[model samples]
Target: MPAHDLGPTDPAVTVPEITASVPTGPPPAWAVLQRRLFDELDGAWRTFRDRYTEPDGRLRFRGTIDDRDGADDFYEAFFNWPALYRLGGADDLLPAVKLHWEAVTRQLTELGLFHHEFERGYDWFHQGEALLMFYGICAADPADQRFRERAIRFAEQYLPQSPTGNYAPRIKAIRAPHNGSDGPRPGLGPQWDDRFGGEQSTMRPYGLPLHDVPGVAEWNDLADEELAVRMGHHMRDRLGRGDTAVNLAVTALVVNAWLYDHDPRLASWVREYVDAWRERSHAAGAMPDNVGLSGTVGEYHDGRWFGGHYGWTWPHGVHSVGAAALVGAISAGIVEGDADRLDLARRPLDQVWEQRRTGLPSDPEATRRPGWAHTLGPGDGPPVNTLPTRLGLDGWFDHQPAQVAYWTWLWWFGMRQEDRARLEALRDHSGYDWTVVHAFRDKEEAGHEPPWLAYLDGVNPDYPEQALRMALAQVAHRTALMAADEKGADGKRTHETGADDGLDLHKWQRLNPVVTEVLTQLTTGAPQTLYNGGLPLARVRYDDLDAARPGLPPDVAALVEHLDANGTTVELVNLGSSRTRRLRLLAGGFGEHLITTVHWNAAGGAYPGDSRDHHLPAGDEVARSAPVQDNTIHLTLPPGRRIRIRLDMRLNARQFAHHTSPTTSRRP
Candidate 1:
């Protein structure tokens, strides 16, 4: 086939660079926090490489490999590798990355694609992740067009066929393939033991490679706006319409739209899909881990099926984060046009925050409360309550790994200030650990920790020191992965995974490592009280008050400056001590700014609704002024305080000076 007809080569495409000239104006607080996260991510990548890579660039896995394909091991590594590249630039680890990539690629080819239990293999989700990893490398290095071109071609050829026709009927199996094929097939690889019942238990079908393959087509179609629209519509109809599939599918489409600089249509699809999914996912009083619009609650129903079930589940973290990130990207893409995407992005994040605040476990871990299940599988079997199995951590219980990646990505990519704050809060509450811990129990007794934390150990048995070593090793692998390839003809590699790809991997590694450690520590008699229910509070103290002067802009400044000076601020001081006073600070002026601190005197010792009471202890305060053009300010009162304040703001005459009146003023 002619080269042009083959689609853009990897080197020809340029992964969008983090422009030195980021969006200007007072940077959002999330952006600032993201820098900190990026630094940490970079450090982690360095640690990983230093520990894992041999002098010659070969990578080793320390985790267990139950199946011949080593699909679990590969996936764990794949997830971590992308994160290191996305958050931390891959300036140092080029050769090692290339070597590892070559190995993995050769392995995939030799294995005739990544067929695990059922038809599960890299050809599904992991392939997309690999493409993303390779694409990112191409973006950073841009030295190899071959990689980029190959990725694009892969997308063009595979995406359309994967989700439609014969692929459509196999959607469920594609997602969570656990049962291995009975006979040898030509294109299909070896069969692996069934673990999670394959695709039967999985929720999101598009999460696998099937969802991301369209990214290449969308990017290539960008120049032809009409074609882009048609493609976007087709994506919406096929992938976006499925509740379980829509989130990731819409996310990929939105990213394509942003890369191509399209209008609101793509973003609208994301918003609608997410909104519909959210409604369907919410139960009478609880939000399920994963649920389709048709009200089908799969294996993730209680969230604890994976492991200890403590933090986030696949649907909550993976699906929710993907949806939110896409919304955020679209919001940024349309900042010059519509504000709806911003609102959509904020909604799910707000739900996460609210759920965190309520002290409810984001996963099924809480449902198993007091008692925990350690093993991986459905909860239908007799509950085995024992030492190793009883120990639960965020990674074992929740989708903390993926959630962290999603949260960090949004922070780095510049999400709305409030949304970022909420994500930060979730991260803080996540109880993450960076080191690995050893597992003393047998494979069955080890429970869900192994597979749940696979990204960290990678086929190695859970030895405390070894787990830590593997955890750190992932950072290096990730860094190297980022440095290997270059952009092809398109700005991004046609076959590369989008930003979301890296995010999923990073989150899984970080969370799993911590979870492994936490579970280990728990087995070693770590205090159970350590699992605090509340989210981490970013502090914003209102101290050094120049007196409670009434003229102060009944705004956060009054609270902030006061906190800075005096160490605390009183939103409402005189509410009757007997009834438990409540104070309300109009947060309208606060805009997207975060509130990290509010210290008021509580007469009832922090009773609910009492200004003096700190029901939700304040940890950090992040606040942002409304866009100057919006003529608004944000207000935050102490947690339980009550004070009447206006949500509206008045713009000074000078604010409008830049705009010319369409018609001359009649008075003039």
Candidate 2:
């Protein structure tokens, strides 16, 4: 069934007035930690803003991105600020986020990296990295006309009639592996030395996209200028042009526009583009990473399905492919309101899993062994769920334990039995406890889903407090790093450094203090969005009705305790000593869920004047219910009171949008 159909649609369904019990105890440990985390986050962001940004909110990077390497890094620094604001970070944080985005865009444009306010012909992986900030801004304040215009304009770049000419409708594919506002760039930039540094440090890791370059037997041969030029020419001829799997990420861009504008053309284009990839994945057996201009898989690699830009052979193989496939599948599902669209991603994942091995080979040099595993299982113990990470002409190699990054998303989007079973099976074979929290952070600043899922399963009861503390520790660590930088507290020499000096291209991400993965998962019941360009989806989002801002009101903290296909259970607590708080809860990030019934506990008898002082009678567990067929619930949380409510919801019931609130000034 279409997910939207699960919502209650009848107008005549009667709803009753409901109130929550006036609980008379100290707030839960998680609630206290949540409030404390928010307070620390506010200070941490202010410190980061002061040290890393100029007065105008521009990054302090003295070096310019004369090429495509640093734009994503620049934008990634502040990508989660808007998300922080949406989760009730300080109000000033939103304006700063906007300023940073504007400043970064202008900075990149001046450096010749961007045109039409978007990246100019870069891989979707980086493009997706750069756009996360833009997407968060829209989610935080969707009514901003500037964001609306940019969303629509950027989405248009991938359409059949795009002014940038990114799409070749004749072949039903994007024209090149690198694409953006400048459309499909003809080839890699001519300044090869500057592009990858004089020694080509970045390119050496991937070896070469194609092995049979006329005279190159080994990567070290490319150290010569002449051989390097030949390699460049071959990469330009074979790797630069063609639709790679990474291009599937464009579906998210188009889907964002449709969410804002409800344009039929935008929706149609997403379905068309995604469906084209869907057809190709099936025909090729395991989704081919590259398709030639003529629309044939492996047309450039002598009929091999794996070797393409950011495909199975080079860089991250199934990892990148799986991320892009998830985006395409989720976008298609959002457009159609059907979970079945997830098959676009599911099939490819299954195909990769079919090639799974028991463990790594005993011989050290037998394959391109990435590394020994430690996170999922003991490093020295027997390997568990060793799946291929990359594949080439020799065969599948680069093996490691399975990653739950995209599977977590698949389960969140579909909420189907099969996805649940698959996740459980993967967990059973993981050879590690699911509830253990790791301190390591990825580019997305996530990867704690196993523990989070355990919490939701009622096993890891302490995850909320543990994760919040983890977030606090991370912020403190990053803040200390920022203060200790050689550029000093103010980052005075940041702009003076050149990229050639090994100026830490990912410095921003490493030092960014804003951490939202724990808050997002616990409060919103959604996974950390795919950092490389996926929508910030949620089961519920909030607004501070009392403060007229886009987060929990002062002294208010929320926790979504349970989530499933049919309903959600959330606890709202007002920790203030006196002032009552009003909160507006929207079902789904874009008001896409229909909250059919709100069930809560209220005082059984009438309140004696002030409800906050009323001690509930013994065993007075009076439950109340209200039939709510819309997407919002206006909550009045009194001081010293906490309420836990189960919201019977139909996921993806309404047209997605940046909806305006009936009370707050938040606009549609």
Candidate 3:
């Protein structure tokens, strides 16, 4: 039986309420945050518009630089317009947005292309992606018939010619480029190969050709069924039946499923695709940087690397994997009603989070601690040069992480409240960007040229005092929300305090109390405990003992030293593996205190035997001191298992409080 089709008594079968828990009245804290966010957004828009928008209202295809003008325009327009709409409402930006839409439509019609062209250029894939954006824009704002017509036309052009056609021409052509390339070849059957002229390639679908064009009427036809069967057969045969292609194919399947809501066959395909990705991700202990329909992981053997090239990048890298996991999690929650899959989606995200927490740059920079290169020049460009590359740096101005976190917030809030709360707390405490930095460098300067550069500088200045202030603000906000909750006068629980009023006053009251207090404390300079400067801790895998232990050998004493130095926390689990190990901590003089109290599973309800209590007298080595303190902590663990631990400590007044917290409360 389908997950969503569970009987009435099933716990997972409850329907979610349609109403959102937006606060009423004037949530001063939310108002402040919103105002700040909007202010930055508005500034970003003006900067983008001034530099890219043409007099005719059509956004410029390229900035005054070397980047691909069309792609840049598409991303900026898409992110900016939809973000504005979602944050405020259509009313706030309807007019400007409409003008841009009109400009885009007119350009598409007059130029006879969905996107810009460079030489013999304008690849069909780019056009298809652009069409997808156009469709999305139309979906968000329905007033433009031309946008809809253009999207439909583009999609129709790629539909299989016959009901039982072997392959869609557009997809076939896309696979032809790598026919004999060193890269993985498409694994489609001989029929597909013969039809497209022998393109040896992996069978992963690279996100082109919209799948919802045919609608349900044609989707349920015998011809469509045959085509799906053939497609599956080709995928299994050529793609090695694995995870790489699973991500893209699954998304395609979901799009098709949405278009044919009642089709059991489509639903089955969706489940299969999701299952395959999940299985692969679990087996690898991480999702592939990218997987092909042929089941071959796309590995970069090419030596031409850039940007520290630390994690993954491009078609078969970290971003692709993260995007796949995100989409998969959301799809699984919506289609299969599987909360586990949604939780599992956090694996890849957690990988990035761990990297962030450790104050280790996800980019190759993590490899070289400091002084790797003296100057920041063009030749020293990043390996996986994507938009996030420029935005991931630590400082007052970088907004990449904030934007990424914000997008994550959208997905989490839309799907699950718990996840939303966790993400909200993470964003609030990260302190990646809280204050506005106002500095002007010549636009002609190397790093100062892009709007991203300006945005980063404006958000975070590179000064010590300013960074400290921003960091304090973040901590205050985080601490305040930790203790806040929403309740009604009648003692009824509610996400928001006020519901009937458009103002959302009650909701603000419930959420803002702690945040307000924290902010107030910070302004008065209260003490605070700063963890990795509010960044995520670096994650080291135990399998690579050397990497996990750094300077330690595979010995107990070495492990203790490593743990002590790194503020080591350990997770010991039993998976029927005979890998019991003793871990030790090195408390550097900071162990003179005891753990006063611990709230195990504070956010989530506690499990059996999960709580801990400590009452020790001062100067008692064993009782008063922890294994590690201030500088170092260590632990012993069994193999093939994991556990979470919270390490607490007291900091001086300087580290305790830096800035006033925001005037609102939140929970994570």
Candidate 4:
């Protein structure tokens, strides 16, 4: 085996670096509000990290969350990194991020990349997330293969295979292993104990501290057996219930894995599952919280939740549903050209905005519900409840906006004008413009308190110096994980990102399975409300949505003077909001490595750029900040309201010099 190479030979075909925005400025308060949702969400995320993540990055929330196993950290890192990166201005505590990523792979249980169950060491229900986490890193940091090879071995692990282990693409869905389903994918790993005595109770609680290996000191707690029976029965009825948001989320994990490396069997199952889910949503006039294999709505398990405000009934469920689908839609669309699925995705999204509901309507005559009341889930839920939600849930519940907004902004890059019009109806739906929160990911906001340090103090209240050291630890100690898809040859330009010949939005988009990381940091907005029921990046378009949203700040105006080889020129106007603090451009879509230097008129157009210009050279130590990897263009907005700012970019030089486009290059 030879080391990878990064070379650049030809430069003609590269799609040069280009970016621009229309003449725009902040709208009236009635049009939008400047709520720092990202800041709030960031604080919450950091708090979660401090409270739950061990200094080494593994989750430590004893009995809370499914995190009883290490996989929870992977789950959070996979989903939350996008928003968190933005909040931290893309400057993540790299050391923490890297350490935890390493831990997730190191701790992957016998089942592959997934963690052992808190009660049992393995469970298929927990399988998909592991793949999602592993592949995400593959697409983001392809050079590292800590778990990539192990992950591929699983291509046969969960297949709908015969006893002989004939794993091949088929026209059927894979049933959960708990249902006596097993294939010859290298026999099962260690039994550890009787915890896996029967597959029926794989998804147990924090007893014995895990589901994989039971503790001897752990008194049997027969009560847990009772709870397991109830949960088992409830889930048994819904085994792969394709309609519920949770099930849909699970499907997303499967599909995401396929995106990284197309396994035909997995691909077929994913397509079939998506098609069924789409048809069900369409016929029901909404996304169902739970549906049977036959595509009919199923019974909701209220009894299981035991009365908690969690589950599909709460706002988080709604958002998760949205996030899941958003991810599924884009991911599938790109891989399979799933226009029909993408179209179906949008329909449900519309209802989320206007109807505030996702559950497909129950058959009018099937169940008994008053005309005014709506069905929250299929078949009125199971007799038992699962989460704390059933216990404390009450009126309406709305979660943070970063998630919904994050997905929506990504959709915009690929959406058409007519489809975009549909979103006008949502401009004031919650006062979000998809710019503020996301733009902050690319900006520098000073004067915020870091209370996460307080948690480390309570043991005895450590001094401020220790707190300072803690904050220092928060700073990244390593460069980003950059893997060249193809090492350069014949003197072709190198695509090694750390060295910075440069990649662009187009190439960046091509590398990742989900939304590209470059695009993740670009999310910014102020839509009516970032609150969504479920799904990643909402899939719908409000026909009457307002376009003037995502307006400039109260004291600002802007103009896109250039985008071609002129290297991204824009004019900034203060509209007079210049109490003289700071200015940030919503740049979630810009290329990190493509940027060479940014110069602003506020800095008198100096060479090498000015500090006030906020210019960061590509591939340098300071330039390697995760914040830059995400996207941002910070500079002082002088009082008067007008000046031309020019950004010099390196362009996608190596890609063309080395790689060829579809027209010029061969894919597949």
Best by lDDT: 2
Flag regions of model 1 displaced more than 4 Å. Answer: 1-58, 61-92, 111-132, 157-250, 253-339, 342-345, 356-668
lDDT (10s digit) by residue, model 4, range 1-668: 11111221123423222122211233322111111222233343454455335676654322222222334334434343432332222234323455666654444443243322211222323333333343333333323354445434443343445342322233232222221113312212323222222332432222222111222233244347554343334333333222343333334444434543556766666566566656656666655544433324533333232111112442234434454455445444433532335654565455444534223223232111222112122244322111111111243233212123433433442444444454443333323222221111101111111121121113212222232232222221100111333345455433322233332212321222111122121122111111111112211110000111112333443333333332455554444433432333423121111444565423322224456756442221111111121123443443443445555543321111101111121111
* Candidate achieving higher lDDT, 1 or 3: 3
Best-to-worst order by lDDT is 2, 4, 3, 1
- Residue 517 deviation, candidate 3, in Å? 24
lDDT value, candidate 1, whole model: 0.29
Query: What would the TM-scores of all predictions be?
Result: 0.35, 0.91, 0.36, 0.43
Instruction: Return whichever of 1 and 4 wins on lDDT.
Output: 4
**Clash count in backbone of candidate 4:** 96
Candidate 1, backbone clash total: 107
User: Worst ten-residue run, lDDT, model 4?
Assistant: 538-547
Tens-place lDDT per residue, model 1, 1-668, is: 00111111123322211101111123323223323333445465454444443444333332333333444333334332422332223334444456666665544434444432122332222222233344334432333455544433332221223332111222321122111122211121222111111232222221211112243332333335454444344333322222232223323323232222223444444344444434433442333233322344433233321210111332233333344334433333222222333443443444444433223222343323212222222233332211111112232222212233334334322324655565445534543322233322211112223232322223323333343343344334545444432333455531222232341222323222112222221111111110101000111111111221111212121111111111222222121223221112211111122222332221322223356764454332223122222211122233223332112222111111101101111110
- Candidate 3 per-residue lDDT over residues 42-148, each given as its tens digit: 44444334434566667444212222123323322333253233223223344566566567556544543223221111222232233333333443343345544
Model 4 segments beyond 4 Å from truth?
1-70, 73-99, 105-136, 150-245, 250-269, 291-317, 337-340, 353-410, 431-668
lDDT of each: 0.29, 0.79, 0.29, 0.32
Give all candidate RMSDs, comma-separated. 20.9, 3.9, 23.3, 18.1
